[model samples]
Target: MDPVKRHLPPLKTSINKYNLHAKKSLGQHFLLDPMINQQIIALAGDIKNKTLVEVGPGPGGLTRALLDSPARCVIGVEVDQRALLLLNELKEYYPERFKIVEHDALKLDLTTLCDSPRQIISNLPYNIGTTLFLGWLKQGAAWDRMTLMFQQEVAERICAAPNTEFYGRLSVIAQWVANCAIVKRIPPGAFSPPPKVYSAVVNVVPKSEQPSPILFKAMETVTAAAFGQRRKMLKGALKTIDGVNLLAKANIDGTRRAETLNISEFDQLARLYAQNNNL
Candidate 1:
């Protein structure tokens, strides 16, 4: 019997009893589509013996699927107290396989939560999803893989290439540290109380070694400045930074706009900024 099927009765009962409704303020759009949930688990691949961490597991739909997978253990971090009761029930049914930590996922120490070779699989809350991902990246190659679902727009930003409108700071930073791509796109209707925008699942595998730390910092600073005034040319946008002789020092055309520059150009500017201090 499928683990999820076996637990269906209790799961449904809890939802009915609690009258648990997805909370928009929490960015909760519960995924009622089992097939889609299963597909997400499949994308993660061979969870058997792997530890999976799920965030905002409202009513454990994905949590149930994770248990059905080869995963040896599953940990769910949820902020909704109403969801906690249902998660706790699932934990009891699969004592050795499931664990629930009732807390805001963003506030928790994810690295210390499990042993190495950890994988994160979550249909994250839309509001904090990007912020949470940036936090994970900063951990410096903590997880084996991260299969996360996010608002389609944000997903596009992560997978977008330079020269595209979607490409920006997120694309640069994420691609610099991880091999990222959108695995699937989900329609808004796939979720309960359907969200206004579609969602996409993205797979991010951390690299063995990252770019120079100094370059990374500079890239961030430069991108923030450049993109902040996205419509403006580099000459005007980067003028705030001292010694920012856009065309000569950065090797970037002063006439070009922020969106026109690629990751390499950004890195070049970053390296120059770090060395010159004046720029």
Candidate 2:
């Protein structure tokens, strides 16, 4: 059957049959619109014959989208018991093409979730989405691509530019390692029990030249210090931080605020800090 034309039960009906309700504490918001889900999957570019990992496959709404794609297989990491039976039904439907790992996505190493050459695609749990992405950014380039959904504000921070209100540690680190962009802005109505805020799908591809885990940590340290006092001048913000002296050493202006510095400049700071501290 053609992926686009494949016959599958409606996601809403499955949710009803499984006695599933979106958990407020878990930050669950099912993207129950089939076409919207399909569009989200397409943002990953191409998966043909590769495995796709989904972080929170609530109600299998987006799971259906992944299965309907030409991807060779889909592995969903889920913690909700309410979703297991419904996902099991999906597994039966796509016996050769689907698998489910019953566990908390945040507790497991995503790289170990499957073999190499995998790509991650999911409507991530809003609460842990940033935390998970930060981990993925630190890990080796285990996956080819990652297409994820995050709260619109989170998405903005991930893709925000220097000097913008949304830009912070997230913008610097994510931009340092990968090409980040928000490909779609989704309305609240797109989800079941719609959230108060809108959502967006982000596409991130790792750069060929990337930071080592140690260097990445250095960057994290500096950004935390710099943005921790975001409104203060760089000299004041980083005075107690190791990277402060590097401003004069690297010819960076001490009068500028943290948000005024770009990714490359932050890299310079991280590198300088790492070298001096013998990290």
Candidate 3:
């Protein structure tokens, strides 16, 4: 079915009416371009029957665009009282389909916000984007897919390959649990108050097979230790943290640097650590 086109009040009007400005302290760089936002919606794929949880819908720019999509419901979770006030207009426009929740995205339990088979689509606030993405990854299959915006460097890191400069703990952790890709890049100009770096939209679909809770923690511990001193060989980097024994058990070479290790090696290290520690 085609998305129903609803005429929304011009986003500018909401900005002026509410005396709104992008709050720097909140890392708010609102996406004001309809074309770009529609591009993000397209990257999210068929949301006709899907619920979308938007992280920070400042002045309802992307929120309005999302409403125009065929998505069954679009829940805009905003922290700023001013932005929530402006979003109330959207709630009135699509009474049943649109809703606003005033909560900090960082601390809010996103899983409780919607029923099963939901997608998280958002132009996330820069301050909390990485933290929120990592949290979702740790939760494992809580949402169907995540189509989210992050600073260019972060997007690269999430999808970076094992041997690249961008590859690190984030790359291993995200890739181990999902198929990640950078679907679109938005220049700084697209935002209300342009951020210093470019922004990109990434799509992450969680893999069916993930490390067990104990094993996942082991992976976190292993990655933290290895990447904490990424310049050093695994042997030297992990020395204080039982690196030699863990690498030997995982069948990984102690001479390799953390950036050189593949995801499978990391998984092995996690498993071995769990086994050795009786986790």
Candidate 4:
């Protein structure tokens, strides 16, 4: 039997019984659109034999979609007590495939959660979306891929190119170690209690070997300083980093703003900083 069709009854009943109202404090927004739910699942691609780790499975909407997929196992880390109750019922219906951990996703150690060749698929809480992505990236080749939903603006920043308004610390950091692409755009209405802004689904596949840690650290420091005062020129903004000598070391036009630099330019600046610090 199709898992979605078989488990639909329990999902509906659990929702009602638990009074699983979306909590604003948790940045909860249940996705009620079945089509969108299935679409996001499809984006996960070739789930067969793959393990999936999902965050914030509010009302088990996306959880249902994952259950219906060919995935070997679906583990959800949910913080909401009401949603956790509903998730427990789903576990009962699909004992072999469903597992719910009642804990904050942000605090969980993803490296210890599942073995390699896993994937993270979630409509993440907006408040912690970027923080979670950064954490996953720092894990250094932990998962096979990440299919995530973020605010449209954040989605653009992840996939943004050089010199674009959306390009900044996020673009540099994400591009340094992974290939990012916006798979699809979902309208605001697709979500229950639709968010004021549109949302987008993004796919991220990490690189085989990431750039030097020293370079990453330098890039973080440089971008933080540059974008922190985005209006200022690169030379002025980067002066805070010792031994930077921005223009002479990076060969970048000092007159240009931070947004004007491409990934390569940032890489050059990072390399320069690292060399200066012997990092």
Candidate 5:
């Protein structure tokens, strides 16, 4: 057995001993499957000397896997006070390497806490997964890569293609600045308090070269107006933003709906929108 495992009890044992049942209010579906946990960590690529930042690590199932790996350290952002107590016990096994911050992942600026050559791997709290992901993408190469878990439906939306049913503002914005792919699918049963929907892990690597903040903000605005009324053509859906004029400037067909437009087209539209509005 690894020396660390000898010191720290398994995650299930710790959970039962602490009576830390999953909390629905916190979206706490504990990842009890060790195999799944290890697999998710593997998707982050090598962590030999890399920092691993895990979010919402309730009961520390995935946290244990990260400790066992050759990672230089594991920094867990946990909101549940009960989970932090359990995680605190891990400090004994890896006194210098494991640290827990009792803070809400959403409110914390994760990038500022660690240095580069880091990777974030987590079975995220379902309620805030997408919002956190969008925030992370905006960090502009703060970390090397991100391997995150989300609902199966959300996973498809992240990696969806143009004209597909799953494609929308999320697909456009996510793909614009990052290379996203579905790493694996995890059934609902994998989680201790299984979520109603199946889960899937996604790998997101942000592009080293990204558009300026103004262009990105413009993209966000354009996608919101475009996909806000997805069924309507560009002319009617984008009327508030001068949709027909914007489309003509971008050399795109005004008859097309938001779902039919690709990321490149959206990028062009955002640039034109910014220029037109002098934004």
Candidate 6:
């Protein structure tokens, strides 16, 4: 037996002990397969002593796996009351190695939650997965890397290429800030209660140089307006953000559609937008 990894009760037993049925409202789908956890951490890169952040660790299946890893510390960000009892057991067993932050991952200030050399690895709750991802993208490269689970469709959107059908504002924003890709496709049967849709694991590592808050906000505004009307030409789609002047400043033809523009073109527009706004 691996002495470091405490042999905890099986997920079903513990889950039954805690009466932790998967909650639909919370998008709860507890992962029981240990192999999946290994693949996720592998994609997280070298976590020898890094702080590993797990969001929505319902029933503590993933949590136990993280603590068992060679990581220096594991923090579980959980908001559900019922799961707290189960996770509390983990905190007791791995007192020095485990910590629990009982707050909504979406509302919590993650920068204040952990130190540097941290990576977020979570089977994120479906409803707030994208919101959490967007927030992380906004925060720039605070973390070393992130391996997260999202509905398969959302995963494709994150890693989608320019001019592709899946590409949109999310694709632009995520690609602009980080190196994102779908590392694995997990089946619904992997969870205790199978979800109707398949889930995918995405790995994100922020780019070396990230956009400043001003420039990022500019990108958000421009992308929203541009992709907001996908079929319209840039001159027409970005009209709300002074498209004509913005395109002229960026020295780009205004006849192109949003999906046709790549990351560099978007960056130019964002920089010009920031300058125009006196930001």
The clash numbers for all candidates, in the given order, read 5, 0, 0, 0, 0, 0
Per-model TM-score, in order, reads 0.91, 0.96, 0.96, 0.94, 0.97, 0.97
Angstrom error at residue 27, model 4: 0.7
Tens-digit lDDT track of model 5 for 176-274: 999999989999898888889999999998898887888889999999999999889998899999988998888888888999999999999999999
Q: What local lDDT does model 6 show for residue 253? A: 93
Model 6, range 1-279, lDDT digits (tens) per residue? 765454766777888898999999998888889888778778778889999989999998788778878999999999999999899976877899998999988888788878898888899999899999999888877989899999999999999998898999999999999999898999999987899989999999999998888889999998999999998999999898889999998888999999989999999998888888898
Pairs of residues clashing in candidate 3: none
* Poorest lDDT segment (10 consecutive residues) of candidate 2: 2-11
- Identify the runs in model 5 with alpha carbons over 4 angstroms from their true place: none
- For candidate 3, lDDT tens digit of each residue in 1-279? 432344566789889999889999998998888888888899888788889999999888788788888888998889898888898876887899997889888888888988877999998889889999888898777778999999999999999998898999999999999999999999999988888999999999999986677888988998999999888999999887798998787788999999999998888888887788899
Off by over 4 Å in 4: 2-4, 7-10
Determine the backbone clash count of candidate 4: 0
For each candidate, what is the lDDT? Answer: 0.84, 0.88, 0.88, 0.84, 0.88, 0.89
lDDT of 1 by residue, 53-151 (tens): 999999888888888788879989998989998888777778888888878877888877789779999999999999999888776567889999999
The local distance difference test score of model 1 is 0.84
Q: Which lDDT tens digits does candidate 2 get at residues 1-279? A: 755335667777788999899888999988888888888888899899888999989798888878878898899999999898889988877888898999988789978867877999989988899999999888737878999999999999999998788999999999999999999999998887899999999999998887888899999999999999888988988887745578987789999998999998999999998988899
Off by over 4 Å in 3: 1-7
